[model samples]
Target: MMPSLERASHWLALVCRLVAGIALLALLTVTIADVGTRYLHRITDGAIALRVSGSVELVSYLMLFSLLAAMAANVEKSQVVVEAFSHGLSSNLKNRLHGVYLLGFAALGLILFIGLLDSAAAAARHGEVTQDLRLPMGPIYYLAAALSLLLGLRSLIHALLSAVFGADGEVSHGE
Candidate 1:
């Protein structure tokens, strides 16, 4: 990877991770608030009827975004290697194999991004909205599609970098 592209990927990864963290935090906060409201409502004998309306919808959306937002960052690492089988292999080979795996992810992400863009357009045309909150679904689908595009780009970049430079510090070491 070139220095500029590497830096861009690093910054993008940071941004994606931050987005994922924030989404997860929001999900947790909403879930806690919903549960707390239920408990309070039960304990107060109908005195406190306050509830986070459409919490399930909120949680499901948040969870989807949180996971999706991290895909860009997670594509670089998080490989599962059953070392018992192939620990003896060369690191370059491992990196190349990992690159191949990431290539597959890149393709998958691109496919999903394209599909999501189509879905977003369809939702906008149909005037779709969340069942409980009645919030427009077009924006949500568009954001998901954008994130998937980012994931695809990141995966493609990482795949190329890993394949060409080897992922085990070989780039820096000139190996």
Candidate 2:
């Protein structure tokens, strides 16, 4: 990779990780606050009432976004393999096959990107919103679509590196 491209990739990876971390933090923060406030309400006999309405909806969205944001960064690290079947395969053959597997994932990510784009458009057209939070679904789907596109791009790059340059080191899913 060129120096500039490598730097850009690092920046993108950092941003994605930050987004994923923030989403997960939001999920945990909301969960903890809800639980604590619920306990307070119980202890005070309804005097200290603090119900987190729409918490489930918010948490689900946060979780989904976190996964989407992290997808690109995690793609290279989370390799799944059936070692029993491939134990006898040569290194070159294994790398080529792994490249193909990554390509499949890339295709899947792109397909998801396209589907999410349609979902975003449909949500915008219908004025759709979350059931409990009432948050607009279009923007949410749009952001997810962007993340899925990044996932596809990242997977494609990994596939190329693996097949052409043998740049990938085998990372076991077991770890």
Candidate 3:
């Protein structure tokens, strides 16, 4: 059961990473096209004024997705570690400290998840939409909330495993 869960989590993290990468690429493409179009319009004196409507809103949402998708993998990989002071600690001590740090991360992720849920509820109730695209904000908020919940769970699992099995507690997903 534990192995299965670990495998599932690993797959989830991989999917998230792929999604983040795609979102980032899409964002880059949109930004480049928008900028190039505007530049061409400027230079051409309105002859080739091909502006993408609602591009700012689209880019903002893409950025949000990219950030949310990458967060779980980042937590799982312990990529955000701050080694300012504990760099020379013993492996056991470091693992313990990392466990504690992961707990803290879980707490923060929980807070964000709750906040996103609240924001989603409010947005749904208020019929909030992007100014240009009129895209409903509630769905995006809810998706982010879900991803944040996953991140929190991942962090908590990592914390518990680290506490019980030390730094090498992490199960490789055949990667």
Error of 3 at 75 (Å): 1.3
Q: Count clashing pairs, candidate 1.
A: 0
Model 2 local distance difference test score:
0.80
Comparing 2 with 3 on lDDT, the higher-scoring candidate is 3
Each model's lDDT comes to: 0.83, 0.80, 0.81
Prediction-by-prediction clash tally: 0, 0, 0
Clashing pairs for predicted structure model 2, backbone only: none
Query: 4 in model 2: Cα distance from truth in Å?
Result: 6.2
lDDT of 3 at 63: 93
Give the total clashing residue pairs for model 2. Answer: 0
User: For model 1, how does the per-residue alpha-carbon lDDT over 66-163 read when each residue is reduced to its tens digit?
Assistant: 89888876777756677986599898888877777788888988998999999999999999999999999999999888888889888877788777
lDDT of 2 by residue, 1-175 (tens): 6333344445666778898999999999989988999999999999999989988888988998899889876777666778997899887777767777889878988999999999999999999999988899999999888888888876776677666666553332223
Assess candidate 1 and give its lDDT: 0.83
Write the residue-wise lDDT of candidate 3 on 1-175 in tens digits: 5566577667777877887898899999989999999999999999996998888988998898898889876675663556877778787877767777888878987998999999999999999997899989999899888778878877877777676567544657765
The estimated TM-scores of all candidates read 0.91, 0.88, 0.86
